[model samples]
Target: MGISLQKGQKISLEKEAGGGLTRIVMGLGWDAAKGKSGGMLGGLFGGGGGESIDLDASCLLFDEPGNLVDTVWFRQLRSQDRSIEHTGDNRTGEGEGDDEQIKVDLAAVPANVKSLVFTVNNFTGQDFSKVENAYCRIINGSNNSEIARYDLSCQGSHSAMIMAKVYRHGGEWKMHAIGEVGQGRTAEQLLPQIKPHL
Candidate 1:
């Protein structure tokens, strides 16, 4: 088990790992909201309208001045410098855990890169009202131990969320849970909402 985080909470990776940490995995998971059943007739005739939600997980690398230096998302699986890599896109939030994952090699990251912001977007245009159990977690890549988790409990008409950020603080890396809901179908569209947090 790991420390569960609320919105705006922050945790230190080195402190949580109990020593130096080199690599970490940021995992995002969610499920489509189950549709209402229309009684026995609906079940027999397949009237339940539960549809799969396509949520995209993205990592944006920023410099000290908050400029976007690189990105890793569905469109681009790896950052330009090769320090951050996204596992790939999962169209349906169907499986048990980690619908999408982005791995970061902290040591390989550039010195100027101060923050890695993680965001989730409803690429299919469905609002979060149609999604459930969305969460972002950080795992120690070495031992697969969960360090921290932030449950995204915001359910509304928004299409995107600036979930959390891993940033350099006093020569160590720390994670802050943002959990801010907004309107964006892609990482590029969410840039404006991310600056305030950076």
Candidate 2:
């Protein structure tokens, strides 16, 4: 069983798995909230089946001093160094499990890249009030086992969230659930907001 992380909780990846984790996957999932119109009527009037939200998952690499290093998202699927890659963009939060995934080769990351911040945003500018069952999970890429997951079930009006972060700690990597909700449709806009949390 995987561990469920609360906001602000931190866990060491190496300590939890009892070995060095070379690769990891950050998975983001969500379900669109039901529209204002009820069941049958909603389906008939383009309120249900016709509606979709585009929530984008991104990873921002930062140096030890919190300097922006690089980013990986829909617009840029892979980092310049190829250490991080976004699987694809999910136009709608359909299906079960992970709607989007960002794979990272921890062992291949540059030495200067000391921290990785994960974020989710409604690229369409839709508020989180219309999103539900939102969650982020860290999976061990080798065996596909989930090491930890953070459920962002707190519905609100914010359009973006600094979901979690992984940083170098004592030569090992650790994860922290930031879970800080704010207003931003892209990672660039959230830069200032992510500073204090680092």
Alpha-carbon deviation at 138 in model 1, angstroms: 0.2
Reference-based TM-score, model 2? 0.93
Worst 10 residues of 2 by lDDT: 41-50
- Could you give candidate 2's per-residue lDDT for residues 1-198 as a string of tens digits? 579998899999877766778999999999888755466645443555336878999999999899999999999999999999999999999999899999999999999999999999999877786788999999998889989999998888799999999999899999999999988999888999999877
Residue runs of model 1 more than 4 Å from their true location after superposition: 36-47
Give lDDT tens digits, candidate 1, residues 9-100: 99898899887799999999998877733776345424566666799999999999999999899999999999999999999889898999
List candidate 2 segments past 4 Å from native.
Answer: 37-50
Query: Which residue pairs clash within candidate 1?
Result: none
Note the residue pairs that clash in candidate 2. none
